[model samples]
Target: MIGFHFSNYDPRQSGKSKFDQLLDLFTQLLTYTSGDVTEALQWLNELDKKYELTDDEYGMGDFIDELKEKGYITDDEQRGEIKITPKTEQSIRKRSLEEIFGKLKKTKTGDHQTYKPGLGDEVSPDTRPFQFGDMLEQIDFTESIRNAQINHGLDSFTMQEDDLQIRETDFKSQTSTVLMIDISHSMILYGEDRITPAKKVAMALSELITTKYPKDTLDIVVFGNDAWPVEIKDLPYLQVGPYHTNTVAGLELAMDILRRRKNPNKQIFMITDGKPTCLKIGKRYYKNSFGLDRKVTSR
Candidate 1:
């Protein structure tokens, strides 16, 4: 929703303007700033001056004004600080989708495949010979008749497997997906920024499911000692806490959420770099971090 000149949209292109580079830098800045608009702007300003990112005509102040004017962010009345608006959250999700999964072709339905045929509104160009289980409507009568005539000529005619061509189609089925992100302290430990990329990827996958597969339901959960679901808007600010990895808790919560969905197609995606170091047993936390804990992994 941040209104910038559409001409500067493609930063990867050969000739990017000053605004394009600034925008790209700003998006990355949000990851470290944790959705603090004011702090992010400050960092952007500093970098702008050092790198000469902006021109005299298009300055950092101009970009800040554009962000506020476009309703991408707003002031938190209670906190009296600049925070990202819903529009900004949506834009972040979209940008993440492009950066991560831009190479994927947009399908009309879910990404998975189904054996059922003669379904879905959009018909595919491919066709196959009619099988016993094929629906009557799936049979291409015109194509079948044409084939019969060509094979038997005008003298003889017979309906056979070679003559029957069944049109193939894609079936749209609702799906329920649970995405679990590991947010234990190790995610940010060793002086690395792993959580940010993970957040970006999670946001991208969430957006992909919401927009490309409207019939699908996506739930995101982060696990440290305990696991809890997170809203899409809260993804950008997700950070690792001083907590141990609780893989079991994350899986339990994800399974619980997926159990309520009506969709038959259900899946779980987990992104993590370390082994489980903690397990919850009836409210008590069992922690271990020295080496691979077989007990935690077994769970």
Candidate 2:
């Protein structure tokens, strides 16, 4: 695991403080453990001894105590375990999402499709004359007020158009999304755990689309020896397998999944590192660990 370090801090502007140094150190530790904070701290202890770091000035122990004190990390008393705070998780997620998705484009309209206010322009084929059951917005307000004034007396300022209001219609947009995740052996090979970040992104995106875009459909497929649909909750525990990359399988599965979706708008988001290494022949899996096979590439 590579340790990450953030060195962009401006001591002049933010002050050359211990907290900043600790943040830098914590980031460095994250690179090593991919934010497996407890494991990183344990490594930090070993590193402190190997480097002979000053205990009073730059001690990992002190830094962790400070981290817990400041709520960046917390202790689960019952579990006897230290865990990252919700704040840290959210910050890491925001940073990770921004890094991968880039910035969300700013636009005049809302990100998602929204219906126009008031009773939609689409009216029933039969337009009945303004009646007691008709919506007020459907009723021409001016004409209604005029009718009320005429029917009542001059003192009948209490106008009655039956307080008609528009009956709002609903419009639905069809959206289909294919979320691709790489499950190549490199994800966890040589002790680097890139899979964690990938899994987190998958989980977050799944949660986001499911909760906020009820009208839209999101399909998650993992590509390794073969691509298949996996539930969102399964993501957090997803692990890299010995199987090599079969990107074609992933794409094929994604396309197959999208084909089932009748939505007019379809999009695919693939997350992968390195090239393809395996392909399938009928029901048999063709293994290739050295290089990309042109046959698979063409597929």
Q: Which stretches of model 2 miss by more than 4 angstroms?
A: 1-8, 15-35, 42-91, 98-105, 114-176, 186-219, 228-242, 252-266, 289-294
Candidate 2, residue 75: Cα displacement in angstroms equals: 7.0
RMSD of each: 6.7, 8.6
lDDT of 2 at 90: 51
1-299 in candidate 2: lDDT tens per residue? Answer: 69987776443355656555556555455534645677877776776577544347666667777888878888889989787776665544444445555576765533354364324444323333345654545655555566567777568566654533334433445578999999788888888778877766775676567655777898889989988888654554456777788988899999999999888789998877778878888888887667767776777
| Candidate 2 displacement at residue 228 in angstroms | 4.8
Clashing pairs in 1: none
Model 1 scores what on Cα lDDT? 0.83
| TM-score top scorer | 1
Highest-lDDT candidate: 1
**Worst window of 10 by summed lDDT in candidate 2:** 120-129
lDDT of model 1 at residue 184? 94
TM-score (C-alpha, index-matched) for candidate 2: 0.53
lDDT of 1 by residue, 1-299 (tens): 78765554333354876655776677778877778788888998898777667777988878777777878667789988888888778878888888888887866654555656547765777888888888888888888999999988868778788799988887767789999999999988889988888988898999988988877889999999999998878998887899999999999999999899988788999988788999999979999999988888888
Query: What lDDT does the true structure give each of the candidates?
Result: 0.83, 0.68
